[model samples]
Target: MATVKTVTTADAAAKLDELLWVVLWQPLGLPRDIRHTLSLEGEEFELLAQENGQVVGGLVAVWTGGTEIELRHLAVASHAQGHGIGRSLVTEFYRIAKTKNCERIHTIARNTSGEFFRMLGFQTAPGQAPEHPIFREHGISFELMERFVEQGTPADCSTAARSRGG
Candidate 1:
């Protein structure tokens, strides 16, 4: 089973970056320069999923001002996609957001992942998604989605996620 944990050290960050590159950027044919420069501006942190001491998935999020967190990137290694690693990481993301008193979580999801976010209770937000020429050329699109954090303790979020079969 894959276990999720918060990423705190530079080494962990680098590992997560490599995982993201392999699972996301590389597949998209994005260059190293574009991938490395995609970091978001606010306070950022990450959660990583590991199995048998190997990194398999990860999430990057930014505290986007008052009561909102923007999930920047979420990816699972191709070899690990069938497992619940992605769900585990997002559940932990919610737990941490709740602990920080955040009231909502938002993400700019790729068209391919909109359904996945929907399953987690995120709704399409009322705004036009920003377009990138490169992504468009690659037949990829983006959507803005968000979900309000239910009023509860951090543990409550985890319990709720499990009950929902996430």
Candidate 2:
């Protein structure tokens, strides 16, 4: 079974860094400051996942309003891809965000993960918000996606469900 939890404190941030590295970042030539900034305090919310006491995936969310949430990242271990770990993690984030009255969610995603986000009800656009720093990075490219929620269905929720029998 998989479980998710919110991250708090600098120590947990450090742990999340390790998880991001071991599962995604380091293997992809990303930097560690990504983890440091994720925990820089005043973040609206974050969710971390674990299986058998080890981190496997995570999704970080920040609130923009009563009905708007920004998905900073939704990462899964390479080995855990296609296992529903990412979906479950995001589902859990939605449950929490809903409690906080967030009915819309947006994400700026890498080229490869846009389809995954779309499957989860996140849509893609050619341009990004001005303050999103998308153009700051030179080599990397991204697309912006948004999902509007109505009665628990994500605005961009595609037909893709976890491949599990559930």
Give the candidate number with the greatest lDDT. 1
Per-residue C-alpha lDDT of model 1 across residues 46-96, encoded as one tens digit per residue: 998999999999999999888999999999999999687887888888878
lDDT of each: 0.85, 0.67
Lowest lDDT 10-mer window, candidate 1? Answer: 153-162
Clashing pairs in 1: none
After aligning candidate 2 to the native by TM-score, how far in Å is the CA of 56 from where it should be?
A: 0.7
lDDT of 2 at 75: 82
List the RMSD of every prediction in angstroms. 2.3, 4.8
Candidate that scores best on TM-score: 1
- The runs of at least 3 residues in candidate 1 whose Cα sits more than 4 Å from the true structure, single-residue gaps closed, are 153-166
Give me the runs in candidate 2 sitting further than 4 Å from their true place. Answer: 8-11, 36-42, 129-140, 152-166
Query: Which residue pairs of candidate 2 clash?
Result: 121-156, 121-157, 123-145, 148-155
TM-score of each: 0.90, 0.74
How far residue 157's Cα lies from its native spot in candidate 2, in Å, is 6.6
